[model samples]
Target: MEKRRLGRTDIDVTSVCLGTMTWGEQNTEDEAHTQLDYAMDRGINFIDAAEMYPVPGRAETQGRTETYIGNWIEARKNRDQYILATKVVGRSEMTWTRDSENLTRQTPAQIDEAVEKSLKRLKTDYIDLYQLHWPDRPINGFGFHSYEDYATDDMVAFEDILGALNRHVEKGNIRHIGLSNESSWATMKFLQVAETNGWPRMVSNQCVYSLVARRFDYERAEIAMREKVGLLAYSPLAMGMLTGKYDSGPTPKGSRKDLFPTFLGRYDLAKAAIGDCNETAKKLDLTPTQFALKFVESRQFVTSNIIGATTMDQLAENIDAHEIDWTEEMEKEAHRIHQSYRSPVA
Candidate 1:
């Protein structure tokens, strides 16, 4: 329920941001509305969504997440009550994201189309934070590690991406800008470009950060500390691996891992680390869910921890995690797990 300043922006967002990536695919429209209502009632003032959501990213259900949020906003008529954040897809082969395209890149024209569609789907005049979903450069994001050949010519340049976002800021379509799945170099370059060009500054970086994945600590943490673009950590529970429900040999039925096995690859590599997390939580007399959720939520460098759930029970447990007092023992246990894993998934 605590709020924090997002970089140098006047916007104040809650440390616990409600994530809605699963809204249309795993959950129905009513369920999405229920989650929104419950989250607001629980004092969560920040909601994060994306244009390419309800994951698995099929052409059929691509934009349903924003539609659900848009309906909720229209029904509640409290758009000003929450800090809304959404992203534009970076270089991707999923061209169905754009009606006439087979490949989507963060080019200026594509950015214009993306924002216009996102605004229409979200039913909002302005987004509090508009994010580049990923980098346009050839890089292994979404957990891929092996290097792939980069095209000699790509559709968009980094500055062009920033320039497009800046134009939106000037036009009031977006209030601020942010990035996700980006490297420390790109983060600093974006900041540098903004400073040199007198364009809008990026307010935050959204990435995967959990007890099992502490790779951010290696370098991104420094960028956050020195550059002021704090982290908006998604998958803070590592897609429910940190919750320990899957440690009894099988992933729980109806859980995220059970529903989407491929998404849990991060946990697959660091399965032992996750087990260590569960064992440590038991030693601390806490549920693995509580321990893992609190461990990420209590981090000093985390601006906000994005929590997702398909059911009310899961949402309640995630929300209650904030109430648990983070003890020294838990911190030490988190560190021990990190030491053993050394970012096995990153």
Candidate 2:
């Protein structure tokens, strides 16, 4: 794999980041270790994880993904070999992430709490890139729309959030900071705040950017290109929907759809566009998975492509997708599909 600069930071991450959300839930520790080993062998130096992961995030299994990575680091004793990135959960109804306070905002205390616990769980002294998983503001996310009255609570201020991250940077617990599921306006605001306050600048924006989900290209791609906050695109395969296995109907057994039926609600809502994209890929003589993955990876705004899988077969195929050279015809087909769907989920 190739290396790319993470925003304006000195760090260089692999173009293909190994995603670990399914590690503790759908896979075992050995399997997680195996995946890490394979990814490393393939020269993938970027590994993304989260504090509340192994999604379908339960109170019991919330931190298991980090724990599995921690175990891998301990067993391998090669923490410095890769660039590690992890995230702090934004405000959500899942209050089990915190204790007794009912606090979900990015307060200084909460940021400290999240970082320390994540470091402990990850069994590492420092994270290469620590990310705010999403905005604390009230917004329709994860494909839900229909705007409600925008009420601004006394949540953590952007400056305070950066301040907290700077402290972690000083302590060497986190080397850099990043954002996810954020908007272009928010990205510019964060940049402005950082520039004015002389605080740590955000290194990247991790968001959903697949062949079917092209909303980022509308606005945020410019932020990435100009501000150096390149994209760490998640769900590049639309939760395996673009893999062409689900087009034949009733969800495959043991697949992501079967395992977490609600996981790909956004893709399901835009199934027509996804079908068109798959068809276009077939017409172009490319498997839908290869076409979708390569298209996302080929984006100039993309710093890295985060890929997840429950099985090694899926993992291997996804990793192999990086080898396929994206063609202009693939881009044209992707654009045609988007013209029809035009962000049905968003």
Compared with the true structure, all predictions reach lDDT values of 0.88, 0.87
1-346, model 2: which lDDT tens digit per residue?
Answer: 8789999987888889999999888899999999999999989999999888988889989999999999999889999899999999888876777775574777788889999999999999999999999888877667845556566654567888888999999999999999999888778988999899888899899998888778888889988999999999998988888899999978788887898887777666787888888888888888888999999889999999999987888889999988988777777877777787787655
Q: Which stretches of candidate 1 lie over 4 Å from their true place?
A: 144-155
TM-score, model 1 to reference: 0.96
* Tens-digit lDDT string for candidate 1 (98-133): 878767888898899999999999999999999999
TM-score of each: 0.96, 0.97
Q: What is the lDDT of residue 91 in candidate 2?
A: 82
